[model samples]
Target: MIIAFWVSLFIILYTFIGYGFVLFLLIKIKRLFYTPASFDANLEFPSVTILVAAYNEEDIVDAKVENTLRLDYPQEKKQIIFVTDGSTDSTTEKLNRFNDVLVLHEDSRAGKMAAIKRAMPFVEGEILIFTDANTFLNDEAIKELVKHYRNHKVGAVAGEKRIFVDQTADASSAGEGFYWKYESLLKKWDYELYSNVGAAGELFSIRTRLYENVESDTIIDDHMIAMRIAEKRYIIAYEPKAYAMETASANTAEELKRKIRIAAGGIQSIFRLKKLQIPLIIRYLHFNTSVIVC
Candidate 1:
C-alpha cells in the first residue's frame, strides 16, 4: 500500500514539474536558433484562397470580410470565399456585398467541415487559408503564412490566435485566456523544434495541393487540416506575428461547449490519424502539458 501511495504521489509530482521542465528546455532550444519570416525574391509568390465558414455570424460578418480583403497580397493573387451552410441570418447577405468574395450558401444545416468541402473545388489559389468568421486576421497574415512555404518542406502554417478578454467576464474567460497563452507557447516551440501538432481554428493556412478533404463530420476542421498535412511528412509551422483575433466564447457555457467539442475531436483524431502518431513526438509532449495545465 505504501509503495503504491508513494508511486502515485511521485507520478503527480513528475507530471507537474516534468511537463514544465520539458517546455522550458524546448523554449531554451528555440531561443538558441533564429528564423526569418520572409521569402527570397527569386521564389515566386503563390496565390491564396481565404475560406471562411459562417453560421449565424451576422453580427461580425462584415468585419470579417473587411479584415480578409485587407490582407497584404496582390489583389489578383488572392481569392476570397465565404461559405454559410446553416445560417438563417444576414450572414449571406452581408458577405454578398463584396464582389470579390465568392459566397456559397445552402439552406440545409450541414456542419462546418461540410461547408469547407463545398468550397474546396472552387478554390483557385495555390494556398488555402481556413479562418473563422468570428475571428479577424492581421493585414499581413497571408504574407506571413505564405513565407513559410518558401521552404518546400512546410505544408501548413498555423497562426497565433488571440482572445480579447472583457474585464467583466467571468472565471471561464480567464481560464480560456490562460489556456491559449500556454497553447501559443507550445505551438511556437513545436514549430521551432519540429512542426506544430495542430492549428488554431481561428486561422491556419495550407498548400492547396497538400490540402485533403477531411471527413464531412469532422468536429475540428482546423486541427484535422494540420494533422492531415503532418501525416504527409510535411511540417505545420507557427507564425506568431501572423495573427487572428476573436472574442472569448459568448459565455462560460458556450465556451465549455466549444471545449468539449475540441476534446472529443482530439480523441477522435487519435484514431483517424493513428498512422501519424509514431512520428509526432512534439504532439505527444505538448499534449502532456495541456491535459495537466487545463
Candidate 2:
C-alpha cells in the first residue's frame, strides 16, 4: 500500500509539474548540440487558402472576414473561404457581402468536419490555413504559418491561442488564460524537441497536397488532422508569434464543459491514432514519455 501510494503521488506530480521541468532541461541540452536550418529570403510566398468554418456566427462573421482581409499576405496569392454548413443566421448573408471572400453554405446541419470536407475541393492554395470563426488572428499569422513550409519536413504549422482576460475576469477566465500561457510554453519546447502531438483549432495550417479526409463524425477534427500528418513522420511546427485571440468561456460551468469535451476527444484520438502511440517498452527504453498536446 505504501509503495502504491508513492507511485500514485509521483504520477500526479509528474503529470502536473515534473514533466514541464524535464522538458525544459531536455530542450536546453538539445539547443547546445543542434542548430535550426535557415531559409532563403528571396523565396516567394506560396499561395494560401484561409478556411473558416462558421455555424450561426452572424455576430462575428463580418469581423472575422475583416480580420482575414487584414492579414499580411500577398493579396493575389491569398484565398479566403468561409464554410457555413448549418448556419440559419445572417452569417451567410454577411459573408456574401465580401467580394473578396468565397462563401459556401448548405441548409443541412452537418458537423464541422463535414463542412471542412466540402470546402476541400474548393481549396486552390498550396497552403491551407484553418481558423475559428469567432477568434481574431494577428496580422502576421498567415505569413508566420506559411514560412515554416519552406522546411520540407514541416507538414503543418500551429499558431498560438491567446485568451483575453481583463481585471473583471472570474476565476475560470483567469485560470483558462494561465493554462494557455503554460500550454504555449510547452508547445514551444515540444516543437524544439521533436514535434507537437496535435494542433488546436484556433489556428493551424497544413500543406494542401498532404490533406487527408478524416471521418465526418470526428470529435476533434483539428487534432486528428494534425496528428494524421504527424503520423506520416512530418513535423507540426508551432509559432508563438502568430496567435488567435478570443475571450474566455462565459462562466466556470462553460469552461468545465469545454475541458471535459477536450478530455473526451483526447481519449478518442489516442485510440484512433495508433501509430502515434509508442509502446511502454520503447518509451521506457528511450526515457522519453513527455507528450505535448495542443
Tens digits of per-residue lDDT, candidate 2, 1-294, equal 999999867865676578678889998899899986556756899999999999999888888999999999899999999999888888999899999999998999888999999999999999999999999999989888888899899999999999997666677798788878887888888788765665889999999999998877787899889888988989999999999999998787778777767767766776787776773232221222222221
lDDT of 2 at 265: 73
Off by over 4 Å in 2: 1-4, 166-168, 279-294
Give the TM-scores of the predictions, in the order they appear. 0.88, 0.92
Question: On a 0 to 1 TM-score scale, where does candidate 1 land against the true structure?
Answer: 0.88
Pick by lDDT: which candidate is best? 2
How well does candidate 1 score on lDDT at residue 264?
76
Task: Compute the lDDT for candidate 1.
Answer: 0.81
For candidate 1, the 10 contiguous residues with the lowest summed lDDT are 285-294
Tens-digit lDDT track of model 1 for 181-211: 8778767866777756868878889999988
C-alpha lDDT score of every prediction, in listed order: 0.81, 0.84
